[model samples]
Target: MENKHPYSELGYKIFFKIKPFLKKILRIKVVGVENIPLEGGCIIAANHRSHFDPPVINIVSPRPVIFLAKKELFEVPVLGWFIKKAGTIPVRRDSRDTAVIKKSISLLKEGFVIGIFPEGSRARPGEFRKPQPGVGYLIEKAKVPVIPVLIEGTDKVLPVNSKFPKLFKYNIDVIVGKPIKFEGISSYEHIAEKVMHEIRKLKGERHG
Candidate 1:
């Protein structure tokens, strides 16, 4: 399956225009953004806590990022238009969507950055969910660097069951961890664990 909506100049243009407003409203503080490579295909594995996660990454990232969103989001009214224009790929959860996999591979090979929430679903505050294996599979298959990202306070900004964000009421932090290379790693689950471990460290959580 070919990617119908690849990364576009328009997306970046729109993002740059709205970035300042978003940062002010969310009080977003980004750290370790320099850890992101200047050029290359890489996977950003992040912990999901709120819908704001994707926008935070897009605004803070040094490069353009394409994320795999659930198929349902693409059916919405205005959101569907924006996500599609931003080059988001629609994925069917809990199943092997061959089209998504193929499209991801194609984008990676073309030196595009991909963002993935390994948790597979948003977790509540003070909760940690085990990561799904799909991110690991992509890491192993893409054979690219994986950067672990930790997002904090988005849950408070826009928690589950809430439509509008509190806006300027909370501070959000996006911490980017060092990239992990999967050159000789063979186990997808192990690689996924390692990625999650880094995210935990960024969140100041202990992991053994």
Candidate 2:
């Protein structure tokens, strides 16, 4: 079957080429990977703590997952170029831009995996931010299953204010929860809150 995702084959090719190196450097351990559906549209909602979060998820996912990045990141030099070529969707943080949302919904309908950070931006280590309503809105509109994920130790790999990422010494763990399909009518904020609740449950289990 023809791939419906907007990302070029070259992106996946490049990823395959370097995935081994990334796996070795990041030392990522994955759990509940089977929770991820083998095919069809779904949202991989995870907490954000580092710029490496997106790549880390992509490295572990069975299918290519596209992410939404801040519009400002696209203007950066090398990082911006790489993300753009990787087919990330840029979203304006300050204003209400429907284009990005529409594009995301379209992608979901196309049966592609879309990755999102409910908190919207990176938080300090051990800190949890309230999720933005955008993720909830997307779920309501797209009516797709959401795979809640919990990621740990990425912040240590690239702590805030550090110019470069640590090549080693940090072990990253990603826990993928069961897919959730919301059925009732609810506000976007409520949906986002519910998703975050699921993510937190994963954290609680990890520590319990």
Model 1 misplaced stretches (Cα beyond 4 Å): 1-5, 205-208
Task: Residues 40-94, candidate 1: write the lDDT tens digits.
Answer: 8888889999988898998888788899999999998998988888889999996
Candidate 2 structure lDDT: 0.88
Query: Each model's TM-score, in the order given?
Result: 0.91, 0.93
| TM-score, cand. 2 vs. native | 0.93
Put down candidate 2 lDDT per residue, 89-168, tens digits, no spaces: 99999987799989999998889999999999998897879999878888898888899999999999988778798877
Taken over the whole model, the C-alpha lDDT of each candidate is 0.85, 0.88
Top candidate on lDDT is 2
Q: Each candidate's root-mean-square deviation in Å?
A: 3.5, 2.3
What lDDT score goes with residue 181 in model 2? 66
Off by over 4 Å in 2: 1-4, 206-208
